[model samples]
Target: MLGVPKDEKPTWISRLAAQPAVHRAIRTFRLQELTSAALKVRPIKRRLPKSGIEYRVRYLESFLMADEIFQRKIYREAFEGLDVRSFVDLGSNVGYFPLFAVELTGRRDLVGIAVDGNRSMTDETRWHVDHNHLANVKPLWGIVGYPSDVKEATFYLNPSNVSCSAQPVLNPDVPSKGRIKEVTVPTVDVASAWMQHAGDVRVDVLKIDVEGFEREVLRTCGALLDKTSSVVVEWHKWIASQDEVEALLRDRGFVRFRTISEDPYCGVAVYRPRAS
Candidate 1:
């Protein structure tokens, strides 16, 4: 019998079959190595520059993350041309946004009033302000609601989840697993807070991010919005319907208002109407 040709041999068939498997294994190994290298280099690539205010953020990255910095950047761009002499940071947990505003605007004349419903959060904000030697930023402990000076309310305090609000979050379905400590604190409207100061303070930007209580905050700040040049708020659907918020602002002469993004948790809207 004549021997089979090498190309047509059984051994050759077996080798060809093995070749693809070998190549696939090699490719998989290479991909794994590439992923490992990327994981190693990612942190270094994300490192902020050595100088400037961004570098200072590195000191407090645990408290404030990259997403928060990006949010502040968005706020800065939204109010670029306007002269922002005063800023009201409603629900200013740990003072990240307000501090970032101070850095971006480079306006020492800017006075930031940081209001937080949580006492510990306001205390933390005070610590950061004092540590950074930011004289203009004032931390106040209270909820921004229907203009009032009362010191007693069922202030719900979540020790672990400190950013959660003292006021009942509009979403009752969402479970608050964190502990609630009933703390005593004052409540005031955004307008009253501005009025308490000695001089005729012109509010250029009002940033409200009070979880799901944004609706009540806006209702209380009606007078302040009338005086403010721009109002930036993280709108929540659970808190108030879009139409209701729009109508409220419209009634206060906020003719031009638009949502910046559709982020579920942190959707931002900028309201710029004719100055009063």
Candidate 2:
């Protein structure tokens, strides 16, 4: 309820619950459990305007649904004409960003590698790719950070949200932390993952949404930095400060940067390599 929008309309179940006839019919049919189960899913399929591309996603289970719905125009503006031939989505829950890239660029042949630490999420992403007959989406299941196999490394799984992370503290002030479970997942360095997944291919767009562990993910990408033209990162003040993130990118030669969101703590930033 906290993250849900103010003007969000009632779900179908809420509407049905309001009607006595609907309840009576369900009780008569003895399908209350089935009906209840079906009503819980929110927006199973999303169709991009003018692209004729439809993606089936678990919208309610992840935070990405809001982005896919409300932030459609923003993504179009940020990546529409970026010439993204090879794209990598870190923390790709159900693979919406990759689909956006393919649809926006109008290049179905573009290479997309979706990386997520959660096995179920990776499986779901693979299913989406297979369901759409997409040969370009490479879904990889592994923790995204440098110095793999650390002793204390653990991923905190959010019960309601699919976008879980290694860092547990979302915000002390924010009551809804969303973390429900913890699991030890195999880790992969960002630089190695880029080379192994995208190899020899210049990644035109690199999108990372690794919850709070962004610094670790960005620290080891020096090898992949030159190949990447546009970098989009969701920075969280709860995990790492914004100044550290900006300075890291600037030191790597991405001098041109712009803030996408007004919230410094929960902000999105776009960076491009400095002109030589």
Give the best candidate by TM-score: 2
- TM-score to native of every candidate shown: 0.70, 0.77
Q: How many backbone clashes does candidate 2 have?
A: 0
Note the Cα lDDT for every prediction shown.
0.59, 0.65
Model 1, TM vs. native = 0.70
CA RMSD per model (angstroms): 17.0, 7.3
lDDT of each residue in 25-86, candidate 2, tens digit only: 64456453344346346535666675666776453433335353334334443563466788
Worst 10 residues of 1 by lDDT: 1-10
- Please give the distance, in angstroms, between residue 40's alpha carbon in candidate 1 and its true position after superposition: 27
lDDT at position 189, candidate 2: 64
Candidate 1 runs further than 4 Å off: 1-66, 70-72, 159-163, 170-179, 264-266
Top candidate by lDDT: 2
Task: Flag regions of model 2 displaced more than 4 Å.
Answer: 1-43, 59-71, 148-152, 177-179
- Cand. 2 Cα-lDDT: 0.65
Of candidate 2, the 10-residue stretch with the lowest lDDT total is 1-10
